[model samples]
Target: MARVKKPKAMNAQEKLTFLLSLVPFLIERERVSVAEVAEHFGVDAEQIREAVRLIAVSGVPGETSTYQYEDLFDIAWDDFEDNDQIVLTNQVALDDSPRFSAREAAALIAGLQYLSALPENADRTAVASLMTKLSRGASAQPSQLAVEDTGSDATLALIRQSVTAGTQLEFDYLGARGTRERRRVDPLRVESMDADWYLRGWDHLREAVRTFRLDRISNPRVSEQPISHSAGDVVLPDTLFESSAEDLVVTVEVTNSAAALLADYIPDGAAREQLEGRVRTTVRVSHYHGLKRLMAGMSGVATVVEPAEARRVVAEWAAAGAARYDGDAS
Candidate 1:
């Protein structure tokens, strides 16, 4: 005999959506037959019955796992079991969706604008409809939120089109050294962080998973050939801060406000509180040049806690800046 395959588990989002929808539907019907409701939702009768049972037992979770009876969902058990009809005695009000705050709505609008830059989002009608619906549903006005796209529109559009068609792309990428290199990449996805758009993809030339800043990429061409790599094989780091064995780990004592800029650079298990009411954060950097640039921007508020070399570099950089300022004053 063949073994029966178990159904795939519903994720937290799926379960939440189902429960929310079920409550509003049950409220509308007042007395819904279990079999009919199950059919409508494309679920088995047993599944619907189990869902109802779960709801009946659930309540507003307190500080502990326990819940009070008054807070629990009430169901007419006799009617449900005997007549196969669902009758809710009481339910929490969740029919109307929560409205987005002004900030939240603005964030969504900014994200949508970034997405709109993609050529794969070719259906202008659909995009406009989506934007209108989002703006209309939100508590804030879309006109109030201003989001700028800093990347090359033509290059980004081509990359998006290539990604959608599952094809490879070739582009001239300008490096930090101001030199341009030709690269062929299997496009995966485009992501935005702090308004900077980056394309995370498989670089066929280098044979590694690489991230290319959209602003640095130029003359992008979509290939006729299909993509030769699986997207699943590539995984990008949560933070784009480069990691290397040669990188120096420089610790700094910073105030709460001052530490925000170093959030992405600080490694795990490297942040600790000091007796002087400051956070000691260890950051990894390629060399003194980057650290000098960072410290110069901080205006002497950040103090290097360790590594003699880094300290020396910061002191020298500061002295040079002071000399430059004095010369300008003269």
Candidate 2:
């Protein structure tokens, strides 16, 4: 008797992790059944084969097509078709376990473990599964890592239900300046960033994609009415994952650890370059003063890398603050 594997939709992060694990496993096994691999990884058989096909073409990016045959993953098509077996002839550098920095490892461990520990968590099974998947080849167990819960159990449960049901959400959202407004949102998905829970959604009144902190929401309700608009119609910006735009384009370089802090700000089209263990991130914003303040606050973790005018403005801001401090000393 054969156990049928159901196809499941995977998020970007999950798909990536699966692919990473798949490559190494295939390399080690040399020859394995597609169904067996799929069953082991909890994915459909087709997905496992598709992942191998994607890996066959993937390589380090360059100006020219410099992907060598040896660098790409090779699969035995004959064996794959005839016996439903995957034969990995080559998988360069994929056999080695990926190393994560202390910060990266700590963040994943803390985030997953905390969610799994929450007694009232609606997605406890999913969180527990993610924790196990992320801990593969890792030195530390995710259960040992912990982070404080960002929102109440009640709030998270309501948000999760609304998202799964495609229901309209009615809630009072407390804004940054302490202004509380009743908001009607088409629930998209609840996202966790830097240990904080945020409800990403289409705001009906504002006609925009907005992210509301789960902790700042009050009197949450799932409306009887379904979402009025398509999520496709409301385009969220790449950097901040919000639905807003400004004219000014800013480029900054930040340490890998600090990059997560500015994740919401980087647009999808923003050019990112890896340089000597740091990331050069470019983003467009309308508010110069706000950007300057943000850069100043980041201190040693971030620097204005381009657009000479922005650098000058930030410098002027630093000098002004320094002089004000000197005056206070006198």
**Candidate closest to the true structure, highest TM-score:** 1
- The reply for model 1, stretches above 4 Å from the true place, is 1-111, 118-128, 138-149, 177-179, 257-263, 268-275, 287-301, 305-330
Model 2: per-residue Cα lDDT over 198-313, one tens digit each: 77788888887777878889999989888875455566555434425535778899998889877667776778899887899886555677577578658998989778989988
Query: Per-residue lDDT of 1-330 in model 1, one digit per residue for the tens?
Result: 999765566788987888878877886678899989988988667778988998898667545756767667889999998999999886643313487766676678777776677644557677667766677666566456655544576777787788778899999998655779999999876776654677877888889878788888888899988888746666667776666797789988877677887877787777577646567778887777768767766775688877998999899888988999999999
TM-score of every model versus the real structure: 0.53, 0.42
Worst 10 residues of 1 by lDDT: 90-99
In model 2, where do residues sit more than 4 Å from their true spots? Answer: 1-148, 229-238, 242-293, 301-330
Model 1 Cα displacement at 55 (Å)?
Answer: 32
